[model samples]
Target: MKIVAVFNYLLSFLIAYWNTESVAEDEFIYGQFPSYFRWGIGTSSYQVEGAWNLDGKGENIWDNFTHSTPSPIKDGSTGDFACDSYHKYEEDSKLVKSIGVDFYRFSISWSRILPLGTKEKVNQAGIDYYNNLINSLIHHEITPVISIHHWDLPMPLQNKGGWTNEEMIEHFGDFARILYANFGDRVKQWFTFNEAWVICVMGYGDGIFAPGVKEITETPYTCIHTILKAHAQAYRIYDLEFRDEQQGQVGITIDSGWLEPSDPNKLEDIEASERALQFKFGMFASPIVFGKYPDIVRKSVDERSKQEGRSTSRLPSFDKYWTDYIKGSYDFIGLNHYSSYLVTSASSDPGPGWYGDQNAVTFQDPSWPETGSTWLRPVPWGFRKVLNWIKNTFNNPPLIVTENGYSDLPDVGLNDYGRIEYYKGYINNLLKAVIIDGCNVRGYSAWSLMDNFEWASGYTERFGLHWVNFTDPSRERIPKESVKYLRKVFLSNGFPKPTLPWNSIQLNEQCAAVALDPDTSF
Candidate 1:
């Protein structure tokens, strides 16, 4: 037995060394992406369009959240004058065109179109503003990908319980009809909602985002249920009413971190890692793909509710009609992935919240490359793994990476090498997933064209390829090193062949070593 164990150890060491050496000496050469593969950059309305309450636009949850007396924003700043994109959209479109991208992804603020969050009144000026933006992108030969709702719920709707109330399904459906009727002619790609997990869990459960409400036990689940139905409603409307004429595709964008087991050899840790993904990604994806929540999620939430002495589960049950309505309601899946986490089985019950229900604990690895955002670490391998997970889970549905970027502190000047390296590693892995692993990924969009309001964190974190001088009244835009890198990748459609092999292999080695180390606790 001892001789066999020695042989296994030596063999594993040799394999690891061989892999590391091959990666170190390999040249960064990858085949061109598919001819139809798209590259783009994105920004949200509230983040870029700063005309808060201007030109008939109504107050949104974000406006209320940031303008509160005791501001929830880390920098005590609001999006009142974000990037002034509402007025300077032409210039923004020019910036996007200069990047040599195929498309530009932006969101529509519900409050901007419907001042009261209903069809009873429509803001013509708001409609004209978006019309000009869309026209500008088209004039520059850039396709427009629009997200209908990006967490900027109209305040009037929040007063009526926002996403937690079932009425939101109809309200959102009505809103979608207005959008399709007005803008569907030009916008070919539509996302019904951006990051449903963040909208429901962070906004309602953790109370850290807009419309902050901390009813941890039930509010999050209720909000998620309503959002899913609302998404389905919008998709059905587009499919039934506008598909033939508009020729548009509608979907939802979900943001989730890849969860890696702390100890691959431990069954509990492995199970906990998968449970975390099912709770996070599967919670939203499964309903649209498989017509129901993951069995583990259903069972765990039901069991927890019972243990908490509740007669019913906090998770709302979908009826047969609604289940069928939501099933296969999408033309594609938009994923907004940024980082990853290491998950382990919790030692004790975490109480009656979402985290407690999963019976799992997640944390970041200190050895991983860090970024300006504490929650985000550049883990490129995680991106590949998550892509594979989605392909396997959903039977390889058409996938688009709606948002992926690296954040930096405000002081990281124009020569930002870190951001360049970050993109290089992530995009290289992205190519590997598509070319080598055969994941059905069709497109990718960088997070922001320029830094704007970053929600609760405000302007403290910058995730833009172009630097926006927030202090200047004009908000001067200057391209960074990362911009040139992305432009090259966009122009070539993939990494170009190098004249010499690259030797800096720390990031790849760290990811591989950590993944293979069974005893290394995350």
Candidate 2:
């Protein structure tokens, strides 16, 4: 077994090396993106804004989480001073303007605005801060795309059961109304929620995130149920009350990874791959697009509950009213895609949890290039495939790539050749999806504008085009090599004729070495 593995590894490396050399020599000419297509970069409130509790801002789940004894953050770091964007909006706006992007996508801190997550006690300071930011972006000719919630639930609300409680739908709706009334005039693109799955599954099921609760059977499902309802409520609020006047679009951003079958020839593997996607992406998307959960999700959870001797299904069911209300609630779909996974059918029941319910096991292929983030791999082709899947599944709803970018280790410095290649491959694939595949992708936003607090991982993972000096009080931002590469891509609107050789030598060497190591985890 060892001898065969070594030989296979060597053969794979040689093949990859030959392909890399050939591609570097070939003249690569890419087609132009649509002139109407927009470009932007993104950052969330908790990840970028450092003033966790200041100037009438209340505590959020993240503030509480990081402040807890023996913090769960990998580096024992908190976002209390994360990039200090709260105090440096002017500087940040200048950075965004320098990027030459058409827009900037950012999330409003729920507690910052409402202070207590309610509309009753509005935070004037918070309102002023965002107003200034918006006015600054507009001053710089940059549109502001706002996400109402980005997983930073006010601690006051989390104490009241957060997303697991049905009352959150009303609270979230009220929050949306306040935002629309205040910022909707200037903010034309509003995302009600960012990455509902991560907010629910990772936060509630795995307990690896803030407001942690690890009850997999019902907690995660209940949270997502509330989230979908809250999203719909926010969408409806904007549609009925503010749409005519504000002239803004409302959407929800859902993060999904492309899943491929481990064995193309095996029916079970293919079925498992589809089931995994349905469980992961469709769990949130289906509610808004198809008016209910995916058929497989419903059936699987129903069957699993029965096996557990429960009289009722663990998965929450939406009645006719919700089915109709949630359907067609979005003006567009906000998609955040990063990586791909190979999935196969679990040989046996994997027990009672989210992964168990799907009956699928997902893993990464050794040949795929890795990133500093353990779960992410550079699989550009998967981007196109996932876009096509969305196009087919949702009947080609107008879509925006909300969050897609590469991450590197903290010490990788500013050169960052890997990130440049990543953008090159992924953006090229994105072009193919829009041009050749005919997917209705409207715009794209890189995951971040600068390095800041990365949730549970703290500052260990850097996913920014601009390197931020975390140690400095000012958090000075320096552009990485990828920034220059992306600026050229943005200025040209697409990849122009390659005047220089494609820089794949380093990436090829790294991936080839990774492929040879059988024990590599990520």
- lDDT, residue 8, candidate 2: 41
Query: 1-522 in candidate 1: lDDT tens per residue?
Result: 546534543443343333333332223435668888999999999998898989999999999999998999999999999999998999999999998899999999999999999999999999999999999999999999999999999999999999989999999999999989999899989999999889888999999998999878889999999999999999999998999999989999998888887886666776787789889999999999999998778989998899889999999999999999999999999999998899899999878878889999999999988789999999887787788777766788999999998898547877777777777677877787787667789999998899899999999999988889898989888988777667877887876443334355864554443222322221
What does each candidate score in C-alpha RMSD?
7.3, 8.1
Instruction: Tell me each candidate's TM-score.
Output: 0.91, 0.90
Candidate 1 residues lying further than 4 Å off, grouped into runs, are: 1-29, 498-522
Highest TM-score scorer: 1
What shift in Å separates residue 83 of candidate 2 from its native position after superposition? Answer: 0.3
Would you list the C-alpha lDDT of every candidate in the order shown?
0.86, 0.86
Worst 10 residues of 2 by lDDT: 513-522
Estimate, for each residue in 346-442, the C-alpha lDDT of model 2 and write its tens digit.
9888688788999999999998887899999998877877887777667789999999999985478998878877887788778877876688999
Q: What number of backbone clashes does candidate 1 have, counting pairs of residues 3 or more apart or in separate chains? A: 0
What are the clashing pairs of model 1?
none
